[model samples]
Target: MEIRPIVTDEDHAAALREIDRLWGVEPGTPGGDRFDVLVTLVQAYEERRWPMPKLDPVEHIIGHMDLTGRTQADLAKLLGSRSRASEVLNRKRALTVEMIHKLQSEWGIPAELLIRPYKLDAA
Candidate 1:
């Protein structure tokens, strides 16, 4: 396929096929250069057409716990109070800056993800 801007789904599909054909192409070669440009164009088109949703801080914490074999009790221990942990996990309380710092420093959760605004329970 001729190199061009990926504007439509057809263009995206064609680029993907070209990328597949160019897979494992040797770097610093003409085919490799085409592969790189097509990959970048496809990525930009996908991001502009279908942006990812923001990460939910609470769900992220829960997912981390699940992945690490941690539990609510562990979260309670980290947060220094069972009720506080519950409130935060249940979305009844928002995470404070202190909590964000603690999670980042202790659990290696990125402060950026934790700092994003998330919905809380009304009641």
Candidate 2:
């Protein structure tokens, strides 16, 4: 197998095409080995070329709410109460450690994502 570091966009594109071509190849086979190596190379290249920016906690929460078609009330339920939810959503209160834990546990959001400093306007 001819393998190389994915350096250029062309290299990345070729790796992607190879991955597609070898998609669903069973493990322990020649094609599968090629697929695995290509995926690793592609991942490394993408990480360098397109580093992911950390999402703001509030924005992330809002986005999840939108994507899931959840209402403020639903968020309130996840947060334990309506007033607390309102306070959080309105930026009247910062997320406390306990609240962050709760969000991570109940909503499946990463606590680290929720632990970042964020602006909270006065109530």
Candidate 3:
């Protein structure tokens, strides 16, 4: 295995293509070990080169809604009222600690993701 630290985007892309070719190889085989190592290297390089933004709380809520077939009304029930749901969804109002706790407990979303500061709309 010609394993090396992936430093550049070009290197990262090349590693990904090689991983695709090596996909489904047996775990204990030579190709599989190389594939695992390359994946780790690629992930490290990508994280260093293009770190992801902090999870937007609103996006998390919307994603959860889509995943569980939930609706705004459901959020309203969890939160309080339809208007309150709208306000929160629309970023017109800030989420309270109580609301965060309720969301975490009820929806099983991580509190860390839900409590991160996110952009709010201008009033």
Candidate 4:
């Protein structure tokens, strides 16, 4: 197997295709080594080409709510009262450290995402 540094988009694409072809190869085999190297190269290319953004806390929460079909009342149970949930969702109130912990633990949301500053439109 001729392994090369993933320097260009073409190289990255070829590496990806090779990885797909070599996937599920037995460990300690030549194909497995090729799979491992191709995966690393693809990761390096992706990290350089596309960076992930830190999501805003409120927006993240709202997105979760939408995805789960949850409402302010549901968040209130996880947070506190209905008004407090509304306030937090509205951006009038910032999430407390305790609330962040609870959200991370209960809703499986990342605390870092929950702690970012976000604006809420005035009702």
Best by lDDT, which number? Answer: 1
Weakest ten-residue segment in model 3 by summed lDDT: 1-10
Candidate 2: where are CA atoms >4 Å away?
Answer: none
Per-candidate TM vs. native?
Answer: 0.71, 0.82, 0.71, 0.75
Cα lDDT of model 2 by residue, 1-123, tens digit: 378999999989888988998999998798888899999999999999999886778888898889878899998887789998988888887888888887788878888888889877865
The TM-score leader among the candidates is 2
What is the RMSD of candidate 4? 2.8
Which pairs clash in the backbone of model 3? Answer: none
Superposition error at 63 for model 4 (Å) = 3.5
Q: Is candidate 3 or candidate 4 better by TM-score?
A: 4
| TM-score, predicted candidate 1 vs. hidden true structure | 0.71
* 102: Cα error in model 3, Å: 3.2
- Candidate 4: regions farther than 4 A off: 66-69, 117-123
Worst 10 residues of 1 by lDDT: 52-61
lDDT of 3 by residue, 1-123 (tens): 367998777788889889999999999798888988999999899889999876699899999999999999999999989998999999999899999999999999899988888889987
Following a full C-alpha superposition, what root-mean-square deviation does model 2 have from the true structure?
2.1
Residue pairs with clashing backbones, model 1: none
Could you give the candidate ranking by lDDT, starting with the highest? 1, 3, 2, 4
